[model samples]
Target: MVAKIITGKTIGGVIRYNEQKVKHGQAKLLQMGGFAVKNLTVNDKIQIFKQVQKLNKRTKTNTVHISLNFSPKDKVNEFTLQRIAEDYLKGIGFENQPYLLYQHFDAAHPHIHLVTTNITWEGKRIETHNLGKIKSEKTRREIEGRYQLVKAEEQRKQKVNLLQSLEKAAYGKRETKASISNIVQEVIRTYQFASLPELNAVLEQFNVCAYRGEKESDMFKKSGLVYSILDAAGNRVGVPVKASSIYSSPTLPRLEKMFFRNKEARKQHRETLRGQIQEVLKSCSSLDEFTSRLRPKGIKPVFRINEEGRLYGVTYIDNVNRCVFNGSALGKDLSANSLSARFSLNADLPYDLEREQEVKMGWHGNEPGKRTQLVESSPNSYQTEDPTPYELKQKKKKKRKKRIQ
Candidate 1:
């Protein structure tokens, strides 16, 4: 289970957000705590939470909004969800706080949102600093074990196979708006993309792309964004849907916020992707070979070729981590210029079994022929590699010609 804690100033906004979901049949109130009333209307719930927040006038960000997300594989019933919510609240030091739990049916995953205030009945504010990383993380682990729920970490470790699983938005096959909405919402929630291009790299695999018009256009001036369905050839083929029209309202402002958040959220998985790329590089003789090898490992390599047919950029969409990273972001060694240089040198070389075996045995070890893992290596380390067998053969030919002359 994954718990996301969001601290906001207003409790009404959080309550209304969930209440809106409830009214739309997209969510249901599962449980409530620390209240005398067993059942309450939407307005009553909002007013009660607002009154509670009023007690702690000094606490500007007293409202604590949390979302507990579960893997789709978990068969969580309503009863189990409430129990988990209660235990999670008690575990995270919110046992005495007034909170409401809502089961949201909007996404593919099973998850619930909990809206509560940190203010106590005595008007004391609960400390929320580092709450998500410290307390909530611990509580999440315990709840997962108690309920036998799928661990969030385990879910991340599995290969997602997004290209095969997520169907592209076909304009005429189904309702274009709904198709685009579903794809856009799912990508926004699941993937860690720090920019629109990075996001489009993943979305294009599903035949959808986010579009912003020319810089001088009125829509661009107003910061408008739209989602468009792409044909197989990648040209936009259908009517564009405004970002605000989507259910989640993935507008430019909201997406920009997510971009910042994703940059930090995806840091933990960076080294893993770098390590995978370095491992594949040991035997890959060309860019094509590198792309082919990484695909099986659930990494999609998107290369940007210039008009002159030169490779100028690269991005890796790691399905295992659900993160997108540009080559330069990984490190200077993995950047487009560096990789192009390395591939050029190895272009004529035959695959070396010894190097391939070294990678399979783990790159970093005391074993002979094994090299240090790229994650721990310096940026210039690739330049220090031993000459390939093909290079050695070419040198020998040069020596033979010199001796004959």
Candidate 2:
């Protein structure tokens, strides 16, 4: 999920961009506050817009391009985009550059619009491909450590893997999807079709389904779909898949109730769950406190991602094995400009009390804020306020003032 942006110069005190173009679109998403930074810092919602202008001048093109490679569609989230950007440029210590991110909707693959200033935040011009590309190699490895991003030349430099070679062979032959789909059919029936719509017709009878994969991840194929076509004994076969490769029931029926479905529904579910989890932490202040909270709600706190199943991306529930908050690869991330930051400081919380106590004391060190638990599942923390014309002007002036000084 990458985005490419074309920035227009500020003319007549205004620069053109999306004017709430998504209000009634197929996916109606509204971001507020530092939503630009928090959500799409690397691509669509880059706050470093000022950098984008510089990038345009430096690159001598109206276009600011980016590629967002992901580790399995299910794992790609807002974090995935940033991780990709960081690997490509930041891992080499390009974090200090001045740049703003944006998005272009001209293609199926959504890439980022990085309008970075050729100059650093301190006004030093950056030479592209200096240490950045080398560091990008490092970032590539780090991201790959967790999940797979598309194989780049750098990885091929490291070793030869089987699937990648096949992919290349398929792609080079032209109509690779058509050529290799023969294998997919032997393993999964979905491969027999040319389009996902055809596959969807088949899933209807078996009550098969499709999901958003992970919110803001890939548009079509979720992570586990590649592994779906098999005998009850479990086997793998497929040419890999595009989002449209697997057809699900009509209207994506059998949709699971996720946090981002209905704005109100997600909000209600997250807020209520956060309150419940927090109370559990606050109540006993011990392992018992963790369990006591869930006992009544019939909710078990999962620490791993595979405890109950893939319901909400939650795997490990508490000892009780009740379905707790499904881990969101993107939902529970922390941000700098906002307060609703949730991090897993307590890796040993569910396993050992002493470890939790040690970690708690080490990180919080008996701070007052530590007494109250901070859960990040709450959804609407980054709402934007309607700024007045004067305030907007003042903000711009202040930015300029800081730049000049």
Candidate 3:
């Protein structure tokens, strides 16, 4: 069994999430623990949990939401699920707490949502520090052994491939949206990507991406994140949904925090990605060719290209290692500017568009194609042979102005 714990300030949202599933026929209320009445309506259950939570007035974030997920291969029953929930609560120090458990058949796997108050009947909040890493994980392994269920350690190893087994929008259910939400939630929590661009390198593999709006736009300025479904060519196919629309609420602010946290957290794997790049570079000549070779190995080479197609920066996403690194994050030698110079020298070609732009912008001695010194001819004199594209453009504009006048 895999356990997911989410603590919140209020129990209302978590209760409503499961109750809605039950109301929509996607879930069933399996059992109620620490409740006087065995038979209660959804509203009755919600009110009961709220009343218990009101016992403790001190704690702000007092809601404890727990989800226990069984492998799709497991044929778990309502009775077995109830026992699992009870043990999980006891294991995580939530025993004797007013909690409601419901089994949700929303996905291919069998999972239950347990909603309860961390604020005990004695008017004290429960300590949940490192609960997942300590109590929850130990309990999960024990449960897996007792019930002979698929081991979570093995499930975690196959998580990337197991994503394919999730149900879609079929059998009269909207699993597509749920599937996307589940995947994004998992990826954000599991992958160590330092930036949104780096995050996309992982998301793109699942045909999903999170996009912040255009740089100067109001949405981007306000730091908004929109999640979209991508097609095979990497083009977004459906409507770009707001990050807030998803259950996990992976907004830009939340992601920015994750970025900084992951920046240093992911550094340990940089050398592995660098080694992979070095191996590929040994067999490749140009940047384009190197990128093509990396694709088959599930490494995406993202380039920051200027208007003149000059590569200014690069970031590599090594999906196999589940790590992302900016070129300089690995080392200065792998930086875009450094790599560009190396590529030019190795191919025996002129320096790339960076140098080309220098000449165009008059940074070099003279413009490559434009005459620095104009011919000593009269201002009104025209070339007898032919007109250039720019001259033709000027004449057309003049003619259009005359017609307008």
Candidate 4:
């Protein structure tokens, strides 16, 4: 079992977060403590929590939000969960405080969230400093022994093995070919991606990318693929290893076959990703908040932006299912254009006003008025406007003027 505690200033925000889950049918109110009323609404809970918070005016960080996560292998039912919650709260000196306990079903594991205030009824604040290390740690251990639950350290080891020991491919730390080969092979064998770019999206997470050279280059014409390690800035850093040289031989032809196979294989799992995204979107008003909220749920949102910083594409990588999906493939509403429009509606400034400010500040590169269009280089890969061709044309013109002079 793993215990995580989050401290906040507003108890209402924490209450609403759990209540929203209940509304979506993803969670249930399992137990309520210290409340005189038997049945209470969301607003009722907030008002009750606020009344206690008002007791200590100086305790700004009064809300204590905790989640107790159990291993999936552990068959913990509601009765056991309630017993653990009650005992754990008492052990942490929060037995007397008013707390709402919720059992969340959104994730694969069995977990319960406890929302309460650290401020007591007597206007005294419970010291939260080192609370996790001193009190919670001791309590968690005692509970584990009492229930015969899987220890947290053992659970972590199991998770690492389940992830196949995958790690970022640092250029100098390991043998380049071997590191890239292991990562690419594991990704190809486990993940479902229909195109090179979708595959690259997953690879980039490990600081590696599959490159086919420039479009006009002979290598690209030959349909050659090379695996290269990416630096911290996403630029290719070491010697590019040919696809044919690797033992697994993940060449273009083989990958193309896998792409066709994966298109159908990953369809059934799309709804799982879509549902998680929709739930997170309900509470988040901005892109950054959306990304942060999804991380704990094992979903990574990859946004493709142009040089002007306009979002052109969005992809979701569902780590739990080992699947990659472009937003449009899931549904029209999940597409980048739709998401951008939603965010604009939630933004403080109007979209046009923000654009005007950006242009005035010269935030959109040197050519402030240049209209950047997204060019679909492939069925799945959306390439933003590349200025290299235009820049080169201007450089050639300067050279000719120098010769004329």
lDDT, model 3, position 10: 63
RMSD of 1: 16.9
Better of 3 and 4 by TM-score: 3
| 57: Cα error in model 3, Å | 4.3
TM-scores for all predictions: 0.60, 0.25, 0.63, 0.48
Off by over 4 Å in 1: 23-26, 34-41, 106-108, 151-156, 163-195, 221-224, 228-316, 323-405
Using lDDT as the yardstick, the better of models 2 and 4 is 4
Q: What C-alpha lDDT, on a 0 to 100 scale, does residue 398 get in candidate 4?
A: 100
| Per-candidate count of clashing residue pairs (backbone under 3 Å) | 0, 26, 0, 0
Candidate 4: C-alpha RMSD to true structure equals: 22.2
lDDT of every predicted structure (CA atoms): 0.75, 0.32, 0.68, 0.76
Sorted by TM-score (best first), the order is 3, 1, 4, 2
Q: Tens-digit lDDT track for model 2 on 156-182?
A: 233221122222112333333333333
Predicted candidate 1 versus true structure: per-residue lDDT over 1-405, tens digit per residue: 988899988777788878877775668998888889977887898888878878879889888999998887889999999999999999899998888999987666788999999998888889999998888999999998998988989865655566655667787986677678768887887899877667887888888878765443456557678888888766776688899988579987777777777888999889988998988988878888889999888899887554455455667898656899877778767766666678763322122221221121112222223233323221111111124455676889899999999
For all predictions, the C-alpha RMSD in Å is 16.9, 25.6, 12.4, 22.2
Across 1-405, the per-residue lDDT of candidate 3 in tens digits comes to 789898888677777777766766778988888989988776788788777777877778888888888777788899999988888888778888878889987664688999887888888878887889998999888888888988887765543332354333221234445546755776786678766556775676677777654333356556677777665555555556688977779987777677777877777777877888878877777888988998877677766554455565567776655677767667666667767676763322233432222111011111222222221221211121123455666889899999999
- In candidate 2, stretches whose alpha carbon ends up further than 4 angstroms from where it belongs are 1-64, 71-74, 83-89, 101-113, 129-135, 153-405
Best-to-worst ranking by lDDT: 4, 1, 3, 2
Model 4 Cα lDDT, one tens digit per residue, 256-375: 778777888888789988998988888888889999999877788887654445555677887767888877777767766667778863223233322222121001111222322223
Report RMSD for candidate 2.
25.6
